[model samples]
Target: MLMRIILTALPFLSLATASKDTCEWPSWQDALTTCHGPPSTYTVKASNGKGLGLFSAHDLDVGEIVMRETPPLKISPPEIVKGSGYPMPAVTKLVRKEFDTLSSAVQDEIMSLTYHITSSKEATMDKLGIIFRTNAYNSGKDIGLFPKIARINHSCRPNASYYWSDKLNKRIVYATRKIKKGEEVYVSYIPLLLTQEGRQKLLDRYGFKCSCDACAQERAAQDVSDERRTTIQKAFADFEPQLTLEPPRTKKARQQARKNAKASLQLTELVHQEGLADYFAKAYRVAAISHARVKDWKVAAIWANKGYELKYIEDPDSPYTMEMHNLTSNFIANWESELQVGQ
Candidate 1:
């Protein structure tokens, strides 16, 4: 009876070990399953200028969740900082931990996996900092999940947006614009709708020269957009002093505030329509402020909510999202308070 029991257990143990062995380093398939089937219909292959990049295997629509991946290794912020100087030791430790946790087959797969490493002090620091700075997938947190999505190159006018869903325990990339078959999907590593100089500085920090269509066009349109945004901002600012001046609140000041607010909204909407979601938050904020000046709390709240939603879509727990939530809540509360006072 004992011998019979041991024979039965042997197959189960063998199967378990085999499962581990097969999953050693983990493939895209493994990550997909782990994340409950994120709408990833792409594969990574070598590209000429960019290193390995994700190419669409089929047509992908806007808002479609593309790659859903778990970090290969999740580390804390301190751990990341410690590993910054010489990460091989930390990498080895992490790899060993992963290997030990995984089945033998997975361990073998991981052992064979290749990682890009830098040896020089300047190069290594630069590389590590870039990784830290450009790492938008997880917001530079020490989360052990590295996804192929991180390798996607940047574009000023990006076709995709990434969101880290804590509920799903995975980082999800969504197409903000339609992607054609064989198109290389990209997301802006930095906010692109800023001034040309600001965008260029960010690109330089990321160690890449951006030649995206939007970047090219922005050189010509930069002055125009800046002038428009500045004019709108100034008009909005001018309304404040009028609001405090004298008793019977003049209609001219109110009208001017409304006009300024409307103009700002139009410019902001134009930016959004131009695929400048990166700057939508700021534009939305300007609209919200204008609406607030006109005492149109509803419109103010709505724009605030829109900005909140966009921030939530980009980064759920970001400071921007929290601010939006607070602003919206206060608006509602104040409205209700005013209603009670009138009654």
Candidate 2:
């Protein structure tokens, strides 16, 4: 059985020195002890105009583990509060219930995370709720708050990526590309397979416009970025099209599988051109499965190894990485049998 790291309760100091009435500017240092991982490879400070942003302390190689943390605050989606008729409140009633359990200092820490409030009336009603809505990361069935990780800002072409790791019971951030020392660390807050305009609309909710590579392109370059992203979206549809349990016994069926394997390889190249480092694993998985469908075990296993390398860096303890690990390591025999058949 896989071991899970339980999130133990944090003992917070009293906020007797500050006003508990309203959330003031937050400092991630307030939750310092809760942070786990390497010794300060990042510096959290004010970004140009984007609030607080994290920066790499030294040159970081691709696949370096940037940071890791077990969220101090983790709870089920507040919408689970069933009796409400409305779709949901900004923070849901869970905010009040959870907030009351924390020390005044932690309560203030939660409140100081985000500035988004639907209205002053709502803020007065539940300030913690507003902050919760603004900063929570949707981790599977639950929502969690990782104060320091939240300091990493958004970029349409982010150099790093993060995901909640159920296997390790923590959140891990990894550099998807080489990052220069002192450069701001970024991760996409929205899906990146969208046109510049489409991404802007989604980012508006975060109260900032993205100026990453895709969004910062010149007019002509912007057109090309949109076209590339659009193509990627279309290509992904056939990335792993359905196949039968056994390799196509019919000539035409076998031809179709061959075409699929070829398309998967082509999409891999396109994804690289688009610079979606975080998506490299998915692209490789598609190729691995597609090649296996054609009974090309050698090529399929190679693709699986490629995916394992990247995912191992991105999320070492994630189920996806574990799957790749099994496919390439000790359990390769069983994995080969599982992929030995397809239409």
Candidate 3:
């Protein structure tokens, strides 16, 4: 079945190459021209043997969606690794089937991606399996192969972050902080909270050394950041119990709530300074809720407003975005008048 698809598309392959302009080579970066909704402010360039990378063409603000793309071929993990069931799934077979169904142009684009040839004696399915494993993003229960999004390289302290939009059936990458013109925008491919050594181990699996700013930091600085990250992780975990308790009924419960909120707020601030922009909007929301839980509406309103602004950047038209907006507006409308009354 897979061979049939490849054979069918083989005839159209020549047309795919014939359509390319000099700028659009067989190279991976040139494939950006084939992606959906890529911002003009970014350009594709060589990344010192990392192949093609996305770079800011001009100054970009925080919360800006740098690029948004819907994957032409998205497959679930179970499909990729179908175990022995009624019918066992074959990873390579499934991938090849999907690849064949794509337009010749699209097939060419997918073929141009940066991937390792895993085995000298590997079959076509085996090679495609390695490519998909290397480049696919986790989309809930499914694994998605996004051509353009896959181009953005890894960084431990990434300036941009990507989010999957169920509604759009697309993945959006946004700048978490100000990105200067010509600066390379990166996303942390692994867990942000991992220590340098841990992050290195993960990067090794992808066949490259991560020289991102965070990973390149001096030992002393890295240790300090790691310690703070560890503290943030532990502190947030401790606060989870109190946060889960339904509105503190007794004095002890109330006290514990306040303590938990305070600790969370502090830890979140450190997280922001450590260049973890992905968590900033979340941290602000946590702070707002903490203050509001104690009837500190004025402070809550302030934090909620900030959270709303940041949330809007991260996800426009999202239910969570609306919730943040509602939180800020309601808190402000209710508290602003009261504070003025006393004044």
Candidate 4:
């Protein structure tokens, strides 16, 4: 059953890159062209109350790969000068090296599109850091890339989950839950389940005040979600000891662990449906580990594959996927052997 879900998801993942020829890339191009003065094939539209957002010109479904964009510029952390301080001579030298590497046309485009930070103490040095900080998406392995997806303003509860696909060499955002036409797709800039204080702090730091539906939910629902998540965390913490304990673990203990893990998995699904993809990966990981401990390789393989799939969406060719692939292979081999013995 778990294998079936993974297999089904592969097709959806492929759709992210489906030909724009059929879906109408011109509208997207026009939108990007209008917004940034670039003739790129991504469109910007009013995302209802969410301000400006990026969306497909054609219909996009769950798991479909969206546009893949390479960052116009790349900056390493060391290359960045901290605080509002002036760039040391060394920093200037590195910036020049990076600037010199780009083609003149690309250089012209970047300089044209660049926006400077107004208040940096080291105005020139801080400008670059601010841009990268706002624009760069971690493509796993500490690599950061830029894409139009970064333009989409965040919601406390987001409609979509963005992953960096290493295999496809693009950042892909998928719907954690179904979306309809004309909906403003959103991604969470911060963890969705954080306490209100934590959520507000993150929002302020990111330069946006979130007024998304989940953030606006009645106090009752919010409290319920908080309580459920707390319970899930406590159950997971409790189960960890038994996982390390020497067996002949009692049947009751094992059953209870599985039950708790299942509840957590269900809660994660609810959160996903509520537009929280950031938590989905962690929730799936817990369930996978619990299933493995119970010797349910099939379910373990499924959840393990889910984690890999989500990671792949964010970073294709990631170490995470490679490790999961190996685990899945081992599980399948073991399953085959067990089948033979039963026969």
Root-mean-square deviation per candidate: 15.3, 11.9, 14.2, 7.3
Off by over 4 Å in 2: 1-37, 79-92, 103-105, 118-125, 243-245, 329-343
Model 4 per-residue lDDT tens digits across residues 211-330: 777667789987766665555456556655644313237788777766755765675566555545666666666666666666666676677667656654444445765665565556
Quote the positional error of residue 113 for candidate 1 in Å. 10
lDDT per residue, candidate 1, 31-107, as tens digits?
Answer: 22123655557877875676667777767664455677766545553344554543544544544454466566644
Candidate ranking under TM-score, highest first, comes to 3, 2, 4, 1
Judging by lDDT, tell me the better candidate of 3 and 4.
Answer: 3
Listed in order, each prediction's TM-score against the native is 0.58, 0.77, 0.78, 0.66
lDDT per residue as tens, model 2, 1-343: 0111100110111221132233231432222212344446799889887877899987777766678876777777644446752234545576567667778887666666765655557656555656666787877667877777888898888999987777556777878888988999999888888999999999887777787767888999889888888888887864545533356778998898899889888888988988988778888888877787786665676777778767755654468877775654422443445545431
For model 3, residues 1-343, the per-residue Cα lDDT tens digits are 4333332433323333354333343322232232345555677889876789989877777756678878888775443324632111365566778888899998777777877554565445456667777788777566678887888998888899987877668888878888988999898888777678877887876878888888778999999988877776676666555443146789987897788667667967898878888777777777777777776776777777677767655665568878877777666655656666777
Best model per lDDT? 3
Cα error of candidate 1 at position 95, Å? 7.6
- Provide the overall lDDT of each model, using Cα atoms, as 2-decimal numbers: 0.58, 0.70, 0.71, 0.56
- Quote the positional error of residue 329 for candidate 3 in Å: 3.8
- Name the lDDT value of residue 241 in candidate 4: 63
Whole-model lDDT for model 3 versus the true structure? Answer: 0.71
